[model samples]
Target: MMAGLLGNNVITQIGILVHDIDKVSQAYADFFGVPKPEARWTDAADKAQTEYNGEPSEARAKLAFIDMGSLQLELIEPDLHPSTWRNYLDEHGEGPHHIAFFIEGMKEKVTLLETNGFPLQQKGEYTGGRYAYMDTFKELKVLVELLENDK
Candidate 1:
């Protein structure tokens, strides 16, 4: 079911760019009285397919996810190359990077948002899902990520 927000899925996750995901995740876990979330890095092979500013990039970020019931907190540590995470850290320092929402038609949603001035800043795939970060910081004050899974 589509969430009420924007007539689409709800904000299911909050993405943060951090200097050290392991450390930051641990801190968050400790504060919440939970175990540290599992960490995974974007595959080196998959890295080549990632895009930053519409060009191929090798950037990879170590990711950790904590399920807070319906909503999740995502931590990202940009380990290599230049990506949206790296750019956020370099330009704005460690903080909230994006608010993520799961959608049905990933490509179409991305295109729709783009036409409204939120261009795709970066995009990549994981095991069964893909995500695209739209550059909305300038107008919306926060980057928005569109996630989709073939589940």
Candidate 2:
């Protein structure tokens, strides 16, 4: 079999899709003994609507960005309608949804993954970085993200 997406990059963040942002955020804060994350809203999040799996939804996400030493944690809660987060929450219940890996040459990496037969499930850019999600998780069973930090 072809080698899996190759790299030893450090995991920069863990995205947790939660049904109750407050509760979840609080729990993490308590567990880690750190103050709660400062909440932020971004149009970047709204763009995820285009990637939904036709679950008949209106997608809105309020995100809280938390800093845990050098690592970042994102707490996401979807609003009022079903979404990828909502679907993941429904199927798996509020918890770690994805792990992001910091990468170099993101577009080239995406090309490599695609050429290796693992086409992207979604690709998008946000304020601090660009991200590509590969659907190889179906067979590989792990949500893999190749992230290019723009900072």
Candidate 3:
């Protein structure tokens, strides 16, 4: 059997960049009639190991997650630092960011994407998983994120 380059096309989350995560999170919650999830900041640079354009960066973002069925919606408000989130927000104001997928072999998937013209943008670790953002906006019309949770 054959598989797609990145293995599968299952989208797990959709990220949105906003000016204020707290306000946006509340708006989304009120619109959906659900409790507003608390917004929190990402780990520090040292802990998250955040990198932007192949260099270490002190980029951080306030984030909140809202589950909608099997898919999740992520709200991001980036700080004044160099990162994919910050760049996109600066260039395009505020709106949708990326669609995310959960993948197993993060290294291999990132390499495959890079080889296929989707360069890795920013990457960092969270509490239970790590994530990679790929520069697929030109071709795919939006960025793509790969999430790898520790087993």
Candidate 4:
């Protein structure tokens, strides 16, 4: 078999865009018999250093994370901004957006994906790490998110 770009193929998270986080998070909690995860907003642009299509962006979103043992489910309600989340929600309505993989050497991995046909769509920093969204919809049927956490 051919080698994988990420070395490992374990999916860490699945992200879904939503119009209303409160309702959706609660619904998921009810369905799963788990406590509703608290919803919160992403960091400010200054802190997140968010970029879309290579341009700086102030896009933010309300988010909630549901823990499902080995996998995580993320719900996002984007603001009226030009971030990747906003673009995906506007273009595709509320639904699954991306599958995420946690990785190291983010810059190199991002470059590898871009060189291999998957282009970078958006990227940003968070508290303990950073994330990049790859435009892989045409090939993989869903966008891909690369998350690099501080170790």
- Which candidate number maximizes lDDT? 4
For every model shown, the clashing-pair count is 0, 0, 0, 0
What is each predicted model's overall lDDT from 0 to 1? Answer: 0.85, 0.69, 0.94, 0.95
Better of 1 and 2 by lDDT: 1
TM-score-wise, the better of 2 and 3 is 3
Better structure of 1 and 4 per lDDT: 4
Q: Candidate 2: which stretches are off by over 4 Å?
A: 1-6, 44-58, 80-83
lDDT of 2 by residue, 6-109 (tens): 56457778778887788878888899998987665534444633344423234556789788877889898866555556667688777777777777788788
TM-score, one value per model:
0.91, 0.74, 0.97, 0.97
**Per-residue lDDT over 1-151 for candidate 3, one digit per residue giving the tens place of the 0 to 100 score:** 4257767688899999999888899999999999999999999999999999999999999999999999999999999998999999999989999999888899999999999999999999999999999999998888999999999
Query: How accurate locally is residue 92 in candidate 3, as Cα lDDT from 0 to 100?
Result: 90
Full-model lDDT, candidate 3: 0.94
Mind sharing the TM-score for model 2? 0.74
User: Which stretch of 10 consecutive residues in model 2 shows the poorest summed lDDT?
Assistant: 48-57
- The lowest-lDDT stretch of 10 consecutive residues in candidate 4 is 1-10
> Regarding lDDT, does 1 or 3 come out ahead?
3
Better of 2 and 3 by lDDT: 3
- Any runs in candidate 1 off by more than 4 Å, and if so which? 1-6, 45-48
| Clash pairs, model 4 backbone | none
Residue 142's lDDT within candidate 1 is: 85
